[model samples]
Target: MLAAKRMFSLAVADTDLFLEMPSSTQALYFHLGLRADDDGFVSSPKKIAKICGCGEDDLKILASKHFILPFESGVVVITHWLLNNNRIKSDRYKQTLYIAEKSMLEVENGVYMFTGSRMYPERNQNGDITEPQIRLDKSREEKNRVNNNGRKTSRFTPPTVEEVQEYCSERGNAVDAQSFVDFYISKDWYIGKNKMKDWKAAVRTWEKNQRQKNKKSKDDEGLEGWLNA
Candidate 1:
């Protein structure tokens, strides 16, 4: 079943080196795509499906098993472990093939092309600026986006120093406090020259403010309720 061709045919078996291995769909993911080689993830289902010669529904159902992540626009990310380790169930793959022809609908041809140019999308692009034959350099602002009901939002709020420390500290947690602090700093919560001092001070200040607020809340809740009780 795993018969690779000299040239890509947009058929599922074409790119899959292990095509004959049980469920051919899993083998499809294993070979052609499924790597952190490029943008850290694959983003085109059409390309993946065409390479697999399967329908989109088949892909989605197979994907839902935690093997693939279908993101906004046409982003389809196959988890590293999914392709290398996990195996796809043949029954599910058969079920998917019986469904609608869900093309990734992104690739214009067997080759992935830029939106307005003949150039193919690749892992790297480096050339003299003057050599750019960009017919339409339609650009997008780079920001970590949050998907809200299928719409991308570009707003992000960073955690303050005190917030970070409190997260590291809890009410008598099992992990050692100092170890937790070290782990937190290692995670980039603390950085630069005067980081340790600044982080400690921030924690103290936040705790002081929190105590004052709680005290005030208690005072307000006391009088009327205290008398009634």
Candidate 2:
């Protein structure tokens, strides 16, 4: 998750699966492999494709080679992941969140029975699936919490230089956007020990600090002028 060391086996590049693919596809394979957990599961292939500047077609290529498998839910599980990466059998290597995907892997033959249920699904009195009904006010609140993308809307994304500049201008503060961006970029946009929660809040804190420094400078200048007069 953090920028740590990762291993890439030479066998991957040597295999027909790697050599046959276009350079872009090869690179995508490595990226997915490196990011996958011990069980070789990567969430949201579509999102990964967008981030890696690849396409769905590339994912299909990997899937065809048995390098990866895509689930209907957009998760991609890397095949034979255990062969390359080593993990301790402790807490970190415990239960996986991709139990459904792992189960689907066993359907090499005709898919016999489909199992697993939706997360946070609405169920009726008889345990039948039904549309969830909520108060209009609560529905609006929930809608606001999730973005257009299925992501939980609360995660922080680093603001662009233009965004920082515009926000500082709107707040009437002379906070240096470049300085702010550079500082965070060096730290990989982390605030304290965690990923930044709110870039706007960080900007506000910078603005307040800048205002105090400017006020102090002006006071010093006024003191000099008074002494001269």
Candidate 3:
């Protein structure tokens, strides 16, 4: 079940942190909040921006100001989501499908804060929320355990095909998730004779390499046509 309405706090909207942004960015924030899931995740922020006659710069501003948090997959989460809608009944609350992204966040003082390798928001002496600060010395280790022989082991876990597809969809990339998994599986999840530490990073690397390869191919075709002409 889904809630019928969304809520906003003046504690957020009335502050300089919110008012200092461009009007389009503020409007986009409202529209995004209206369309976000019960957990405050907006999976199609770019599409929403397009529909609202807003530009990428509006989204970027909101993200930069800590009004929203952008994931590499193109999804955005409202930073003050919990503060805005804390009264919703649990029965009507539907969890977001972005579990991987959700897992990296933590609620602090009724606001959503990132727990991973990203900047987190805080307040200054004036009681106004300030820009994000780099959270240092945080470990993203999945798990550590001792084996039967008393040797500790920590292994990299590969993402599922569904997760890969979802991440790629959020990123608006055309990478074949199944093919990526199969190729890594064939190599026993090793990247150039070393164990792959992060699959998401590898995906970005693949996307980058693919784009360069595609550009080179087009340039080569252009050169061949010119030679023939």
Model 1 regions more than 4 Å off: 1-22, 32-36, 81-229
CA lDDT of each prediction against the hidden true structure = 0.39, 0.61, 0.78
Model 2, 201-221: lDDT tens digits are: 999998888889999999999
**What is the lDDT for 87 in model 2?**
45
The digit string of per-residue lDDT tens for model 1 on 26-132 reads 65555435432232244456576676676554454334332343443445544332213223346422222211122422222233222333322122133211111
Clashes of 3: 2
For 54-81, candidate 3 gives per-residue lDDT tens digits of 9987886776566887775678899888
User: Which has the better TM-score: candidate 1, or candidate 3?
Assistant: 3
Q: After superposition, which runs of candidate 2 have C-alpha atoms over 4 Å from their true positions?
A: 1-5, 89-91, 106-229
- Locate the minimum summed-lDDT window of 10 residues in model 2: 110-119
TM per prediction: 0.25, 0.42, 0.56
Q: On a 0 to 1 TM-score scale, where does candidate 3 land against the true structure?
A: 0.56
Clashes of each: 8, 0, 2
- lDDT-sorted candidate list, best first: 3, 2, 1
Off by over 4 Å in 3: 117-126, 132-134, 138-229
